[model samples]
Target: MPVTLEEAHELIARAHRRAGELGSHVTVAIVDEGGHLQALGRMDGAPPLSAQLATGKAASVALIRRDGAALRDMQQAWPALFGQLDQVAGRPILAGAGSLLIRRADTVLGAIAVSGGQPQHDDECAEAGLRGLE
Candidate 1:
């Protein structure tokens, strides 16, 4: 199913709540299948850099339609190609704040990326948000 604005809002809200519970502020970004930004939210305490990273992560997932971790692994296995990817917008990054592809029944609707906390915390927050979609 295509991601609706309401779904995006709920994902954002869930991410916000998870961030608060984890005691970490974060920036959350959602993008459509075409890697277009659908929604973005930056918590008050989140670092400015998170805005870019979050957006990039979301774009990466939307474009690749794969988990960010798998992309990272691919990059690690081929540094040359990965370096080339760096020159491109919405490739992949090692920043690690839970960037993921949003899927429903094998259909990639979009992506969600979170940043500004520990990598694991970011993943947790993103996962929490994605879970709300179900």
Candidate 2:
């Protein structure tokens, strides 16, 4: 099933809480299966650039149906092709540690990403966001 807006908000809230636990401010973004922004949350102390980065990372995961780390590997292995993907998708695609594909029972619903913390911290917060679905 597709994720509901309420669920998206819950995910953002969980991510924000995780960021607080980590002693970091972050921006969390939720994108639909179509890689369209569904919701976004920027914590009080998050960097301004984190907003765009979180959205791009989430969209990359949603459209690619893969985690951000794997996408980073792809970018490393095929820089040219990966560069072309942004143009092809008409959206900024960034590979990093903060993004995850949202899935349930083998069905992909969307994706979530967190930014402004350390890469590992961001990844952990993204995971927390996914746990919101549970």
Candidate 3:
């Protein structure tokens, strides 16, 4: 199923709520399957850089249809190839800790990314967003 605007909003809300619970000010980004930004939410205290980081992470996960950390691992293992992809991808693709593809059954709906806190905290909030969708 394609990700709906409503679902995107739900993802942002859930991620924001989770960030609060974790005592983490964060930026949450939701993107469609094509890696287009659908919705974004930034906590008041979150660092400004988080917005860009979240979007990049979401786009990377959506483009690969895989976990963000997996992409990070791949980048580490193949720096030359990963660097080349940046020119072709147009948008920045950051392999970060808090990106997750949103899938339903066999279809990839989109992706979510959370950033600002420690890597673990960002992942925790992203996980909350995923659980909220279920």
How far is 37's C-alpha from truth in model 3 (Å)? 0.3
Pairwise lDDT winner, candidates 1 and 2: 2
* TM-score of model number 3: 0.95
Local accuracy of candidate 1 as per-residue lDDT tens digits, 64-130 = 6677788878777987876776567545544255888888887899999999999899999999999
Candidate 2 global lDDT: 0.92
User: What local lDDT does model 3 show for residue 7?
Assistant: 84
Please give, for residues 2-75, the per-residue lDDT of candidate 3 as tens digits: 67888888888888888898899999999989899999999999999999999999988998888988898889
In order, candidate lDDTs are 0.85, 0.92, 0.89
Steric collisions counted per model: 0, 0, 0
Model 3 gets an lDDT of 0.89
- Model 3 ranges with Cα > 4 A deviation: none
Candidate rank order under lDDT: 2, 3, 1
Best by TM-score: 2
**C-alpha TM-scores of all predictions:** 0.91, 0.96, 0.95
